[model samples]
Target chain A: MAEEITTTEEKTVDKDIAALLTSPPKRAPEPTPELTGKIVKPKIVQGAAAHYKPHVAKPEIQEKLGFPGTLVENWQEAAVAKMRELLGKYKSLQVYMDICVRCGSCTDKCQYFLSTRDPKNMPAGRAELFRQVYRKYFTTEGKIFGKLAGAVDFDLSLLAEWYSYFHQCSQCRRCSLYCPYGIDTAEISMAAREIMDSIGLGQKYTNEIIGKVHELGNNLGMNEAALRNAIEFVEEEIEEDTGVPVKLPINEEDAEVLLVTPSADFFATPHLESLVGYAKVFHQAGINWTLSTTAAEAGNFGMFVGSYYHMQKIASRIKQAIEELRPKRLVVGECGHAWRVAYAFWNTLIGPFDMLNQKYPRPQHICEFTLDLINRGALKIDKSANDEFVVTFHDSCNVARATRMGDKPGGQFDIPRELIKAVTNKYVDMEYDTIRERTFCCGGGGGLLTDELIDVRVKGAMPRMQALHNVMETHGVNFMALICAICKAQFTKIMPKYGIPMEVAGGVHQLVGRAIVLGAKE
Target chain B: MSGLTLLYTLFAYVAIAVFLVGFLARIWKYATTPSPLKIPLTPAPVNSVGVVYRMVQEVGFFKSLFYSNRIIWIGGYLMHIALLITIVKHLRFFFKTTPAALAWITSFEIYVGFIFFGALAFLFLMRLVIDRTYYLSLMQDYVLLIFLMLIAATGILTKYYVRTDIIKVKQFVMGLVQFRPEAIPGDPIFIIHFTLVLLLLIYFPFSKLMHSGGIFFSPTRNQVDDAREVRHVTPWAVKG
Candidate 1:
């Protein structure tokens, strides 16, 4: 009987691989009027969900991060042991596993489930994938009844399911908003990824980037010289555009603030524009700020892999920079999850900035800074500068749901909008549901932003695309402003595939950069 | 006492013992476990008083469910509320004299029975009709719901359709509570209902029904969004 079961599992695995190879690349279907609404129902599409899985991390990358170099012979035991350890460590995991009543409130909340129509992509369904294993190994009913209790043995097929389905989740925490108990699937997904990594299975995108952050101090692996060159290029461009020679200072001591942002701002288009906007903001406000080569990157991929130690290690680089530079305050630039880490996790991870000035927020968001200046009338504005395009803000999931911006609770949502409205006249919001704390992910967050997962990424963007399409038809909205580097890059690549121009996606500060007067304040 | 009466008395003690011990153990585990990060789903309350108010709304009103899907909220809220009222009405069994405060609850026991059964039936039917719910519903999920439905049905039957001697039933329950054994009346429907209730008590701690207790321990609902102001340190996590 066991042999027969193994053979069937092998056959199922082969079938999934075949489907993946032969399947056409999934694209966002054109939104019809009926399909574009505030509360859209999930459409069923067969075989659309099982065809994408990210490539696994190489053995060296796995070993460098303190995981096994290859799949252990006793991987099942190791995985189960890790689960037990996590269950003991995290109250979120323990309570979430026991409490879900399967009420189906979160069924339609996940964008992946809505777009892919894969039942496993449902938040509860995805959680059950982990819960089933927990039941099999931990619960008494599972011990006696097994399959009758919805428990499955830890087998190769289950491992494959974990790989395919857990990667489908963006860990955006949108589902938690609707969950009656606030059962954040992001917590479950993080636990699942941690367990997988323990058994020597890891995703190439997240683990490799984490490895880069360990070795090169950033995700992009750019050294100090390249970082300086990039800053020089931005300064040269600022001078060319406004003829103001705005200084993009790097590694300067005694600066009041250290501006830590995603390295993508140095490499990617539109992301670069936001970097320029930060420089222009600092220039206009006349606040002394310098970029740190030690902590050049702000985005923390450790959270994606569910490694708290690694997340702290990566965040500590900024702590090291802070101690070295003695900056009075820390300001984080436009990146979604980075802000979540900086604002929410950094105090716990690496904090007690007792040496710095305490009057300003320990770590302030750029929008909060820019909006503060705009409110004080310290920066001159040109509202007509962005009149060529009607704009709307795409609230990144982490910023929208995970962290706060100003002193208030929903300040993350308001500060960015206030900044955009202060700079541009044609600002509008997308849809009420899709904009604020209930926002959909850019489909490429939580380390699925690699090229190989493009199929899953494009399919996941369907709901957000539909919302954007609705506003486009109704409001003639030409530009979608974003606060996340991943959202900016993802939408820039994804909008073209949906028949929207790439230029339609840009940074909120891109609008600010266009409209901010570059001269000394009045 | 008859042989059947002695068997039931023994079963009742064992089931209650297991239920109390297991339920407390699970709650203790949840209470003692450390949540390392601040992950309150925002728009969360900022202060402890606000957290208490938020939790009250969640427990009392199922506020998140009301905002998520109205139909599920109606089914869940109705069933949970009805069950609470019915349980309070059942307090008459344990007390030699029913308390004055519970007099109102006992008066509406029959209507509460109807709502309880009706809501349980709705939830069970939903498990079959809704596609997502159907996919997630395991055999145990269905079995537990159907078992509760039958318990509710048998209870209503004993109360109205075939009246059992409530005086004897109360004496038996009061005797058991006071540690003085008495012969339980052997009505067939009553026996079945009593046995099912015992089974539910045994199953409650081990099954997903522990959501009753687990909800309070959910970190996302319980944690305050004060990570910036206060440093939340756990013993297990490394100190910086």
Candidate 2:
């Protein structure tokens, strides 16, 4: 009885703080009604429009962007040398050359191929380009009867073709599944991209994003102040919705958990709701969690850019943030590629972190977090809130099968489904060919989420759109909930184009925001 | 039965057991290993027609077969296909005894024997004569190839030259399959050859031969490249 009274008093104190933070006397004029509608359209949003527009190369900006190019002294020469070195490494290129039986099983497997309806996008042809070169360089018949075998010399024209063909690939391991010999063309592409980037021929957009991440500590140029303001803003929004002032604690000194998310959420819509979802859960659970303005983003573009150094450097910011905050656990935000890089590679680089005097705890994604709450019976959610539509999950490639076991690294997918079941009415899966490891790509993977690649992204997203359209047409799926920030942003932008006007929620966290009945008496 | 034939049968059964156990074990391990990432890294198609054209060209036209190191690609594939088809054709023996409608697909085993033995001969010659290949080929690789060639050669000789009693051969095999007592092969050479073949079978699961099986489990090739778009959470991913 005494504990109940004290809890009520504490609730009253929180309500007082919430009142002060929100409903500020003379609240700023409704964000100018123009910005509200404009926010949904990338073109209408001036900031996003300007950011997305193809960067007009300015001499000064170029000067700032310019750096001593990669280790290769010359682009073409170095590329040739690298190609020769790779070709020479294998005792017999036979394992790679003869591996492709070309059952055409992998033809429809590429996101780009499906998106563009182009044949070269097929993994078989991409490999043939290299195979031809291998033949010419190493085979006797290829030396004498090159045309018969489609073998050719590694010339400047071929090098140019390699650049064009290679960049078109996202290095997504989708084709690897259908490949009979387990040949990952993506690994080959990574090596190819690294070779190209070494010669200062890296894609401008990918390089710029990597540069931006380096400069501002995020893929977007969101600074510490903007991040803090975004967190504070989301906190207010959650308070308005729940009558509970959820703390999106930013850089709270000595917090138990350092929750890191992609900066895209602060600026984007669907993921913004996801942010609120997380805040609401922490508020209800009375968990000690804080968001760091620095190293706020979970998505790292360095892996896309083919820079090992950049990947390590980008991960270092997170490591440093964790060390400085000394959080008991680091919670990763909703970003797929970021999670893959973090989970797979980060522990190896900035690690053996004995200097921190603590074993680096494995990071938990937000989905894993909510599921834990549900499993522990710590949070209650009303299933009625989600009864309107039949939902299906689109598996993010990074989360599903990238690790050693090639399954869920954290045993996480079920939590999202449980959360969905708790809130939504009916859940259905896309046909067997779709969903799980067989699901379609959002087309904007591997740093294609930027505005500059909208056309390409939309085209690539066609397969997924078609699959989702088929599901919705057949089963009436209204909402597509995904965990990756890029998927949310990509689907939000491209799904509507294909008449699939479904809203993307960033995993189960969004449901918690609307469904978790807060302020319930013990 | 000659001492060589008995010794050969003993070694052959042991080899087959090891190969079957190892291969099955590896496959079980692979299938159970979970892969959830969908990062499609396959290069984009240049055009739709081009992709199909390439597939047809590579698989049907044997474009990949016309290698600079022609000896291995051509000889290796031919030998592999020949051996596989020959084994499948040999299903006549097992099926004929099952008390069902035994269809004689081919009565003349000689035709099947020629194709199998001929391909093996070509492969062995390529390995021996090809300068670069011979230099690079490991001892185990050569030994495995040689062992297969020898098995095929001995099987051919037992059928066409020696004309070993088919009933006796059947009885011996059936006894081995039933795990019962039976007389081993009378021909010492046949016994030696049979033993070597068994050793190859036992070694099958442990060697690079598993590549034929590991193809299904490789995360790189088998997972669709959807990581850029969909969020795949494995049923077994780490929880809080």
- Leading candidate by lDDT: 1
Lowest lDDT block of 10, candidate 2 chain B: B37-46
Off by over 4 Å in 1: A1-39, A43-47
Q: Ten-residue segment with the worst summed lDDT in candidate 1 chain A?
A: A29-38
RMSD of each: 2.9, 19.2
For model 2, how does the per-residue alpha-carbon lDDT over B75-135 read when each residue is reduced to its tens digit?
5556666666667655554442743333344443446666766776776576456432343
Please give the range of 10 consecutive residues that has the lowest summed lDDT in model 1 chain B.
Answer: B102-111
Model 2 C-alpha lDDT per residue in residues A170-262, reported as the tens digit of each score: 666676655545466665666566666655455556777777777888877878888778777877777777677778887786887788888
Highest DockQ: which candidate?
1
Off by over 4 Å in 2: A1-74, A84-98, A101-103, A134-148, A353-361, A403-412, A502-506, B1-240
- DockQ of every candidate structure: 0.77, 0.06
Positional deviation of A173 in candidate 1, in angstroms? 0.7
